[model samples]
Target: MRAMTYDTYGGVEVLSETRIPVPKVGPGEVLVRVRCASVNPVDWKIMAGGLDGLMDVVYPVVPGWDVAGTVEYVGIDTPEFTAGDEVVAYARKDYVHGGTFAEFVTVPVRALAPKPASLTWQQAAGLPLAGLTAYQLLTRLDTGKEDTVLVHGAAGGVGSLGVQIARALGARVIGTASARNHDRLRELGCEPVEYGDGLAERVRALAPDGVTVVADFVGGVLDTTRAVLAEGGRHASIADHTVLGAGGQWMWVRPVGADLAELGRLADAGQLTVTVAKTFPLAELAAAFDLSREGHTAGKIVLEV
Candidate 1:
């Protein structure tokens, strides 16, 4: 199978197209013929050694976690799916030896969910990781209709979905984004606030009582979160583990079939959607990683397998 591999932690230049044996399906795993895979910041972060101390890695690492594809084979005892089933998965394994940027990727059945019928392969591939992150954070916070939610980086991959999911849950959303994305935020039913030195003041102008839930997808806004939060408000961050010291949860997204399924259901029901900012062919994984590293794309980048 053809896959992109990096022999060591470095920049996008380290990624190279190579042919390797297809991964064996371990017990409770499935072999997916990948149609598309999404590029996330974590993918590049791992490639550049930012997460070196936190997780073990094997050389010639295949780096991607989000996949939308068809099941080509099922592992022993994996009865939840059969060959030829369409699926999407947040295929993060315990280690980083193999991944979805390939002709085929192995997925644990527990991380597999049917792709949303309303989404294209590119969109489905984009949904698993970012969509699940937003869904999990909001659920963990128990954000609900009565609450007013403030979403930091609300036009980002996870933050954009956070805005939509909060709206679906009936929360009043105030989203912080660049002025360029303010209209997009409004389309998703959020009160758009320009993110800058006066972000707290902008959010305050929208919600005089302050927000009840804060979901920060971008880091370094802890004080701003404090400034705009109402008493008893809950907050969390996916980017900053330091949040744990300040009464907020620092989250790493988990690969859960149930959670992905819920997100898929939301997409199929028109309650949620995934946006693909750009795409590259499997061999051009380096270029895709470059785009992700640019850090300004408002939507997910993808690799077509």
Candidate 2:
């Protein structure tokens, strides 16, 4: 099997395409013939050693978490799937272990879910990790039609789906994005608020009572978000905010298969969409990582296997 991997944590340049033996399925696991894999900021973060404190991946680790693939083999204990089932999953490879960046990967059967029928492998590849994050955060708040929620970074991978999911849940959605995506946000049923230059004020002009919940995928300068939230509002962020004040709840998201299943259902129903902004072949994994880290991608970047 061919894979792009790094022997040590460093910059993208450390990544190299090498011939490695394909992973094998163990008990309760399935071997997947990868069709596509999603590139996420965490992939770059781990590659650059940003998460060394939390993950102990051995040297020469592959770096991807989201996969949309076909089951090529099944482990003895994995009865739920056969050798030809299509699946999409958050494979938990960011920290250590093999990942979807290769021609094949072995993932726990519990982590895999049937890919949405409405999506190609390329689109479904973008959904597992980011979609699950959005699902868990929104559902945690129990937000309803009566509530108004603000989604920061509304045009990025997770935020894009978050906006749609909020609307599907009947919340009044206000999204912060660059003016370029204003129409796109509106299409997702969110009133677009241009970020920066009095972002809170802009949101206030849209919702006089203030946003009752906020999902901040972006970091820093969240005092404005605090002001936008009504008292007792909830805020969820993927980024670390050491100085965030206590006006509302703050949390970090963890991957949940149940949440990804729900997201997959939404996609299958044509109620959600995964936008793939860019794609690269497995050989160009380094460029894919660079694109994801640039912070301006319109949607998820993918690695086609």
Candidate 3:
């Protein structure tokens, strides 16, 4: 099986396309013949050793987590899915290796969900991680009717989804983005605000009493969150851990099949959608990573296997 692997952490220069043995299916896991995969910020961060102290790195590491494909074989004792099932997964394991950017990859059943029929392979591949982050953050905040929510980085991958999910759940969303993305955010049901020196004021102008929840997808916005949060409001950050120091939740998305299935259901029901900014062949994983590193893609950057 050909896959993207890096023996040592560094830049795109370290990434290489090579043939490695197809990973074997183990109990409670399934082998997926990859159709497509999506790139996330964490992929490049892991490649650069930014997560060295946290996630253990295995040499010759394969570098992706989100995938949509067909199940070729199911391991013994895994009864949830079988051969020929179309599925999607956030395929992160306890350690890094045997990832989704390959012709074939093994996936634990816990992270697998039936692919939404309404989405294309690239769209399904794009949904898992970002959607999970957005949905889980809102869930942790207990977002609902009559609440006002602020989303930082509102036009980026996770933030865009956060805005949509908030609106779907009956909250009025205020999203922070550049002037160029304001119109796009409004179409997703958010009132867009430009991020910078006076973000709090802009957000407050929309919700004078301040928002009830702040979802920080972009880091370095603790002050903005503070200024625009209502008294006793909740806040969470995927990028900034200092949120914990400031009495907010600092979260890393987990691979929950049930949670992921909910997203799939929403997509199939036409209540949710995913945006694909770019797609590259599996051999061009380096270019895909480069695009993600640029940090300005409106939606997901995917790899077609």
Q: Relative to the true structure, how large is the alpha-carbon lDDT of every model? A: 0.93, 0.84, 0.93
The TM-score ranking, best first, is: 1, 3, 2
Residue-wise C-alpha lDDT for candidate 1, range 37-114, written one tens digit per residue: 999999999998988898899988999999999999998998899999999999999988898998999999999999
Please give each candidate's TM-score.
Answer: 0.98, 0.95, 0.98
lDDT of 2 at 140: 77
lDDT, candidate 3, equals 0.93
Candidate 2: where is the Cα deviation over 4 Å? Answer: 93-95, 243-252
* Residue 44 in candidate 3, Cα distance off native in Å: 1.4
Q: 227, model 3: CA deviation in Å?
A: 0.5
| Residue 118 lDDT, candidate 1, scale 0-100 | 99
lDDT of 3 by residue, 58-113 (tens): 77899999999999999999999989999999999999888998899999999999
